[model samples]
Target chain A: MHRSYYTLIASLPHLPLHFELDRTPITRPRLNERLKLLEDADRDVIDQMSAFLVWDRQPLDRNDQEVIERYDNLMRTVSNPLVRALINTRINMRTIVSAVRRRKAGGSPPVGVGQWVDHIRRNWEHPEFRLAGRYAWIRPFQNLIDEGAAREAQRLLFSVNYRTWSRMAEHYAFSFEGLILYLARWEIIDRWTSQDANAGQQRFEKLISETLGEHANLY
Target chain B: MDESLLMILGWTGIYGATALGAVGSIIGCSRAGQAACGAMLDVESGYGRLVGLSALPSSQIIYGIVVTMTLRGNPLTAQSAPGLFAVGVLCGIALLFSAAFQGACCASAIHASKNKPEVFGLSAAPAAIVEGFAVFAFIFALVVAGGIPQ
Candidate 1:
């Protein structure tokens, strides 16, 4: 047994075990890929959270039904409605004029973002794109002023909403409030980048840029 | 203070201080432009009730120059009124330089404000305080020059 052990040890090469790929076929995407998904989800989260944060649930009018249907379809296709809505909204963020230009230039607009927004009325629908709409409506996270009595209530609601929504995702579980914390991070990052002009946002901006590839100039 | 000397002090200080302030105004203008870009980004979602976020500093430089020039000089001194003159020069120059520097600082504050747009109002307080010092200096110079025995 000792000789056998000695023979085994002697037979072993003076190299790392990792170098000898035992052909372990670990099937799946990588951690970075997962992270990228998370990052994309995060952008979606930001978009949906923003809609909730800054929009009112005024129902879509008669002319706006088509847009709403598309939005609903997009939202339903993804596992999480809020995340899906957020992602779709963010992905489609084009300036109103540019959106107009694109629409006119393209001749017949496709089933993408522009078609949905154009038909919506301001009273029933909330449009995030600034140059396209007359009014900008954002549903601030809390109904009551933070200075008033319901500060804790607001905080609790924020968390619960985020946690619940996040849990719906296959990998990450997030609630509404968790969504807020993520939003807060986004806001802080936005503020930091804005103020610290020298400190370039290679990571966050690059992620956003990639996410926005063709529509980079939308905002 | 002698009358001729008073004239020399008043005009010279007024000219020098105003000129220095004018130089500061130009520098401040450039800085304000940089600050404005960040401001534009921030104002994307926020309320911008106040109109002069970028142009405000340029106005300050103008105010400094005007304040310096408008000061009353001692009537009696044909000669250099050393006390009256020194006060005018020091105060004029002080206000001018300080205002200019404050303009640059204001631009920076505006830039800083882009991130935390909610606290843009906070920047005004510090800038106001600094402006107060310049105003104090200017007012003092005016008072001293006016009090000089012609």
Candidate 2:
């Protein structure tokens, strides 16, 4: 029987849409404290999910081979169908985006030892990789990628994820599934907010460096 | 239809009314109470209201008790056993389901109210409606019990 975590779920702050939030609703420490209420087995599942899903927890330099290996390992060990679906969805999105990025860079479609890679290779010439019907955002996402609008592309992806998680949360309210969806939505908001801030900071640094360079030329 | 068997079933009806009702209340209250406790951790005030809402399902048990008493008002006999069994078991089943569903409604209300306290009263409308069904069953059972031959 699935255990409902009413107390734990109720303790969580309401998370607004990723674009609507300038910052995360709950801080890391408080979120962790609330998560501590999960059963030991649940906590282990969540830990595994965090390792795979949480953006900050993943190293920036992981290569395709390592990511594929991790994905395979997760798929093999994670027995929960919902968790597996979540992981698969995220990895598939990443794979599609990576394929788009590589295509834009004039690279051939990757030949790899994974279902997603094989699908991408077969559909290399198709504009939406024949997935636009299933994922309505794919064509628009591809357009944004092709335009080199990285920020908008990222926002579109985050919004898609936000909406997906929101629907899942609604369907599984007051249960462990609801909690997982809540955390997933929280991560989207957190990632979007941090990325927005980082982009602003980068622009600021770029302007300052240009101004500094002009001053050096005058000297 | 043996007279003794009829008496046994009639007694079963009498006891089942209260037992089933109590079971429903137990389940309903437990579900709603857990939600209330969870909501308490999120909010600063209105703890009383949340706790009170959680107790809404407790009414089913009271309804069960009333039906059981009414069913017990007459001595069990072959003539009235079927009537008692029909009214008592049916009413108990109705009360059981109403209370269980009402608890779910209350939990949803608690969840909504915890986020936006302004909707607290409005959010309880569904649970109130569920209680209305239980009341209907309770009243009808009492009226029907009176008609059963003494």
Candidate 3:
């Protein structure tokens, strides 16, 4: 009963690996145009998926409780096993990253967060939350975190997501699952490219402000 | 059992050859044609080749017609009826599967070729092999139908 979108998938340009790309291959508007081919129900699923995964869909200023409630609502509403798995993986990754940041800030294991908090609480003392066996990248990622290499840690996270989605994509060629995986990978690449651009812009602004300050001192 | 019943079954076989083959061709061509249409949207030019590949499964219908004709030439006697039924149904099934699988192969080829045009020829190799199997079924049905009592 799963519908295959041969035309939609074919129309999409091949997305390069996140680290390899300097920019996204397709723009959001063009991608949206292609997505118009999806059935209404599938479009609803996509909207739900974006609500859960897309960065800008949720406000950045929400508290931990609000974010957790949103996640709980998404888990309750989205019935597709594949979409659920994707959402779970994304949340787990976020949980791990959040744990790392909290530990770096010298905070104790968080409370009232949800089920994932238990793992963080249990393994608060361990460097990789004892998840090194399951997540091989965690040890290196933790190392990057501890060394204060924020950009490198970000890149490592992007790489892990890119590789995971790429492997998932192999099993779902020419199907709706394949299209979802493609979109996930595209989102990662888009996020990374935007982040890099933002960083460059910030650096430029900082240099300009310093020059302006120096001129003011001379006056 | 009854001669008339056997004759009716033989008729079913004759019609089933073309009918089943047409059904298979319909499904196969639909699948591959959708892929070809998709590929056409991705790439400019080379549209002819994609459309051509999509038509590869349509050959099974022709093979079915040939098999139908061969079976029809045999007179419906109790002696020949069973042979016609066996040859017709089996040949139809063989053509059905081959054409369906060939369509899948063609679709895959179109997808690959759309991305990397250099592999277009090589990618069609699998579909051609499937067509070869359809040809075998067609030939065998004809040879066997000729041996059936006219």
Candidate 4:
């Protein structure tokens, strides 16, 4: 039996079954414990997350750019096509949201931001990024951004992302790579929600219900 | 057909069916065993489900054995020997594939359930369906065996 793939996957650890992020600040010890479970292929994503913990707010400072670069590096290293496509959908959503935010501010985005977003925007229709486009909420999100609904667009982006991850978790339940990728995305969302527990709870509750539909028993 | 030839064929049918069943079991068990070992590394509890699912493919061989035994009861004769050989080999082939495919299904179930224990019962449904085909072959062979006289 060719089980090396499964063995590699089984060696990785998973998040607790009853994971909740509302009102609970992520302690360094807790974060580190989670980090220890990931393999080397996911190290850059971990580093980016650690950076984001420090630089949570918007406007993209030098350190935040470093975090983006780390995320880009992590994206490049992912071997699974579906996981890679999911990550691309996230990057596209973020870039579009950031561009909308910058446009509304009536100033140029932080140096290098416009160029990167433009590159991703141009290439999204390419064959390589075709699968990513399938799950992307770009068209409707772009309409929201165009209508000056930046806050709504941001919330909708997260909602769309939650749905994508939920779909992946269901379809790829048997795949180790798919499970790890979905969990990583979920943890990042959890950590983000922890920063503002009240609004996060309301936001995620709506999104979770929408994503899970009648199976929304994940209270 | 020669009387000696008929006797030899009757014996061949008996042994061949049993041997085929053993072959299917060996393949199925090894495949399921690999998945079980992988699942063991993933969780601290609920190992019973994984081990139990792994053993499910072994039933195909048992079905093969039953068919073989049913065919072995009749006396050697040209008319009876050929019918026994046909039923025994075809039934063994069916059981063989069923067991092997069921093993693959069980491996997938074990892999998934190890990660998310909630899906354990649901994941076993596909493997059980595969076993149904083996049961069909086992029953049909037994019924056909009854028609071949001593």
Candidate 5:
């Protein structure tokens, strides 16, 4: 029984190369269909993304607030450590954006994210701070934030997260955990970057080259 | 000991080695085969490579058979009976473990290659290294058998 359970955990779902991400401005039906390929843990996160588009005045006053709540739910429940790290990096990116926006409005820091941002500020070198895969890029992200380049900071965060995924894939290639996490992360990025396939492909190739070159030195 | 007892002991040595080799092969093949079957679920092609790689542990049995044959001499006299028993049993024990561990290596290779088929050849390197130990035992047994008095 134990052996069977191990096999089940190691058996990842098939992800075809022809994922058809080129359909920019992906319609709801197309997005849902593509999402069916993900494991339950990842699917839940993407499925709840629609809740971010709350135009009506209800329990959530702003779409951004809904997004933050969804992110908190995702961070709390995600099973994969690699995925959790990537999610934390994204959350930190959001916090930076929020911090800049709040400062412009002469308001205070937001709730959960603001507290975590404060924690990172105090203990950036702590081992626990490394859990988010942000330790390597935190100062750079802060620099971008200081420059008022939120868009550039977001792009930098995404690239850093991509590097983390690459490193995990290299270190844990024998296990299914890395493969599943990588494919899921790639799917999310594919959605975001599908607007320009040529540029996306170039960026992906550059990331892969750089990652493999780095691994060559270690092994 | 009597001639009959000595003969029995000599024969036991040979048979014991053969039996242990069979046990090792069974274990090695079963483990590797199971991993190959599991790996087939993920890939589109290259099922043959995994199945072929799974057969690597069977070499241990070949080594065991050679050692068993080497221990068999004309006229199992009292003088040579103890030497036969020693060589057969020792080589059998070595081959048994070598094959078992080789099987584990092959299983890991199969599983690893399932996700990244490109690494199939590279992954088999560890299992091949394990088989080399069996070869060493095989050669030493043959050399030691020659030293036994007929």
Candidate 6:
């Protein structure tokens, strides 16, 4: 039902309760409006990532999930390990009505930590599913990954506050720096200066197009 | 008919009384500790970067001693020193119970620190410091009562 995401929207002070309630199936128009907002947000992530790779003189491709995953695997980072993470988790939980509103309207953690966890499960589907997607991104990982490794991947989802999937949802919940660095680690971009080049961009076009666009199609 | 019989009886009372003091204070300390840890965890959630387990268990120790003194020692001395004993015992009881609850506050700080290890490192220090004042008052009463010339 994708309850949490729209539930949050419905609760917005001036937003129509129809967005969360009214019990009607989501219409194509509403979905389109949401997708447009999402694409705009996604483009900002791409632009920021492209700028970072350019600044670092590294190759990047926005369309390839594998490259994105590769870059993401490398550029892994964490900031404000506790409060920022808690806030990020709260946002993921759909606890923050609007980061903007919260700052302007006094938002707080929605209800409970357990509720936050439940919200995360609902949005991402399941940690196992997210883990499967991540595993599938990195090829030749065929022979049953260690259960612990799978668990670690799930933990990293929260550890990284699921910034990757954070974009998958309609809400764009992270900063430019955060998004760029996160995308960079997983190598999801199409242009890189190359592992060896003075000015040549690695043109990971296949990587970027595959990850963001095709991956969505595969699942 | 020897003083040995009196000494055995007296020491047994002292042991029994002190044990009760210890148990009550222990519960207080446990509650205080949980509260402190909870408060700390809520604020910061820094998994492995904090320390304060010591303070969590200290208040009860002080409470036990005070209880021991008030419940057993004070009356013996009261016979010898009349009005001095009553005032001293009165002060001791107040000090002991205050310390017990104050310990709960420190425990609360501990609880908070546990969840959010980033909480002030040795967090909510001022609360503990206040509790320390009450403990000191407790100690002073214990000291004064002990000197009542029994």
Best by TM-score: 2
Candidate 1 lDDT, tens digit per residue, B1-150?
565665676576556556655665565555555445435533554425222554554554555565455544434245435654566467656765666656555664564455456777886666667777776776666566565555
- Go through the candidates in order and give each one's C-alpha lDDT: 0.44, 0.83, 0.82, 0.63, 0.63, 0.38
Regions of model 2 farther than 4 Å from truth: A55-61, A111-115, A198-219
Q: With candidate 3 superimposed using the best TM-score fit, by how many Å does residue A18's alpha carbon deviate from the native?
A: 5.2
Q: In candidate 2, what are the lDDT values of residues B17-133, reduced to their tens digit?
A: 898898889888988998899888889999999999999999988999999998998788899898888888888898889888888889889989988999999999999999999
List the lowest-lDDT window of 10 residues for candidate 1 chain B.
B42-51
Q: For candidate 1, write residues A140-168 as lDDT tens digits.
A: 32223333434343343334333433343
lDDT of 2 by residue, A1-219 (tens): 588887788778777645446567888888999899999999988998887776434633357787767877888888777778788788777777778877878988754334578878888999878878888988888888778897898889889988998977788868888888888888887787777776657667777778797673464
Error of 4 at A55 (Å): 13
Model 1: CA > 4 A from native: A1-219, B1-10, B38-51, B59-73
Error of model 1, residue B61, in angstroms: 3.7
- Candidate 3's DockQ is 0.42
- The order by descending lDDT is 2, 3, 4, 5, 1, 6
Model 3 bad stretches (over 4 Å): A17-19, A55-62, A111-116, A198-219, B1-5, B147-150
Among residues 3 or more apart in sequence or in different chains, the pairs in candidate 2 whose N, CA or C atoms overlap within 3 Å are A7-B38
The single-chain TM-score for chain B of candidate 6 is: 0.50
Fraction of native Cα contacts reproduced by each candidate: 0.00, 0.62, 0.46, 0.27, 0.05, 0.00
Residue A149 of model 5, lDDT score:
82
Estimate the overall C-alpha local distance difference test score of candidate 5: 0.63
Q: Write the per-residue lDDT of candidate 4 for residues B1-150, one digit (tens) a residue.
A: 787887777777766677777778777766776677666865788878788888898887778778777887777677788888788888888878888778778877887787778998998899999888888888988998999866
Candidate 4 lDDT at B64 equals 75
| lDDT per residue (tens digit) for residues B61-107 in model 6 | 45545545563644443233433434444444544455455554455
